[model samples]
Target: MPSTPDTPSFHALIPCAGTGSRAGTAQAKQYQMLLGQAMVMHTLQALARVPQLSSGWVIVSPGDSFEWPTVNWPDHFRREACGGATRAASVFNGLGVMLQAGVPAHDWVLVHDAARCLITPEAVSQLIEACRDDAVGGLLAVPLPDTLKVQTSTTQSAPSPSGPRVDATVPREDKWLAQTPQMFRLGALHAALAHASATAFAGITDESSAIERLGQSPRLVPGSAHNLKVTYPADLAFAELVLKGRT
Candidate 1:
């Protein structure tokens, strides 16, 4: 895993197939305007700033009707309509497309969320620097500081009409909230995802989880809280504020 002429290069892959239903936007959340540009544009622009990233790819669903913005995209940035029904499926398909396009098996692929528009080039570089030479690659994450609660229904085997009750208080000291630009070897990640798909494991929510299936632990590089995923309507406004402050 040492970097050499024979070692594979790193590339960025953004999964853009999600509909962002929670955001309740008229258009897809990634396509929604944020500070005069598409939300995903901000994400791509940040990745474009990472010099170590040789190229970037966006995975879109087949027959996607959303039009690309007229703004000039970077030469290294490209889009493919090979997205699948689920995020894991989309990443797996994109990995296959990259392989067919001549990317090597050992090449590093940083799978990022398109909705994480607040991610910076520095954060992307941080992940790469930490994981580039490691046996198992890693991802950007933040230590969970909130007091977590395990809620349960008051009634047995059924949810209470009123609401769930706090059944337990979980320790937050050891918890770290996972974030992305989850870097892993293309071959390993593809294989892990393929295995999950074959077994119908719907819990493979992130690249790290997929990698964990192979009994390999990916490193966790500390990332800023600003690198939040835009999942709700209020998140858009928060992202805009963070972007404006950066400018």
Candidate 2:
């Protein structure tokens, strides 16, 4: 968890380099419009608005030459061109730059995704206060309300003329959907990512997974359901509505 001002300082990092293939647009989902501005611009702007944020950096996808003409880019951000095959790689690379640029190991590092355009100042403050203890890192996550299914395959002939009966229904338990703004101690996170990289688990989606590998469970901070990642087509519509309220 990250300590407060009286305890320790912190910095923020946003990984905008991801190519969101699930959104199925020519441009990455982060660059897609939410209202009039780029989706990523909202996410970065929200971070910039947070008074607690000491500094931030963005990692852009290689050769993505498109630049937003109207958005107010943060002065503290530095762009990195090289990103790894996985999300963990991109984060680790950014952390390296931050570490070298005078960010302390004990200072908190908040990692948020670019596609999460719905993130707001209030939500960011929630995450910051929730991460006030350094032993366990924290993230903005919402509890899962729907039942989950685990699939299994069985050998069978071609489908019969009659419809087949449905199998057992899954039960909903204590499942939570993880969101970003995942805050952690700089040294702990760096070590966790390094260990995961050595073990060849490059496909981890978020920072919590890497920390879990080190045997420490991260603390969960409640987040708004409205803070959705702009991935698929429908998300654009929802984001538009959310942004309209802001306008």
Candidate 3:
């Protein structure tokens, strides 16, 4: 279906406040160089291609000291320095800023990961096309292909280090590994995240989780495995290779 005049505008929100300790980088992972540019620059470049997006916002730490790139940014792109300590907090805070700026509650918001530098414009467009008119919104995800194992271990064994034993094998038939640009309505997401914060829900890993708390199941659009999140040092090289392949 085509978007009508009443259809809410789509906006992009990227949370980039984390330290990325596991990445083993001296600086924040988003600012780390990838393909001769800051990693987050690639993410923003992909977002800029989505003409349907009304605007793009990056949530950064209040005291962030990293220097922004000198390249010309998209005219619709903006940055907010009200990021919080946790990912959920950062997103929620950014949402507040959007509301203050008069962005309608019913407007669609695509929350993407800054570290997912391999995310392509095609993948982002796929997500928007699938969720633009969806009642509950959705996200980009890839199904797991590897055999799953459930480990059993207890922390009480202080005498010696013991290896975890596989307790069971989980069925991967209906399982999907979640990825981003998670799309949802601004009001609904804000309410969900607020509820999570009030209830002290520490497991609010992603925006979808907060939505799930409201009993809404978001659709999972198929995404490529190449859209991997750059979590570790080795993953940076893999992302670089993917970028090179595109050229």
By TM-score, who's the top model here?
1
* Candidate 1 local Cα displacement, residue 15, angstroms: 0.7
Best by lDDT: 1
Q: Write the per-residue lDDT of candidate 3 for residues 94-124, one digit (tens) a residue.
A: 9999999988898899999999988888889
In model 1, the Cα lDDT at residue 125 comes to 92
Q: How many residue pairs clash in each candidate?
A: 0, 3, 0
TM-scores of the models, in the order given: 0.95, 0.88, 0.94
lDDT of each: 0.91, 0.80, 0.90
Model 1 lDDT tens row, 151-243: 984555577677777888999997999999999999888889889998665889999999998899899899999999999999999999999
lDDT of 3 at 152: 62
Q: What is the Å distance of residue 188 in model 2 from its true position?
A: 1.0
Decide which is better by TM-score, 1 or 3. 1
Count of backbone collisions within predicted model 2: 3
- Prediction 3 global C-alpha lDDT: 0.90
Stretches off by above 4 angstroms in model 2 are: 1-6, 154-168
lDDT by residue for model 2 (13-91), tens: 7787778899988887888876767888888888888888877888765776767554488776567765666678888
> Regarding lDDT, does 2 or 3 come out ahead?
3
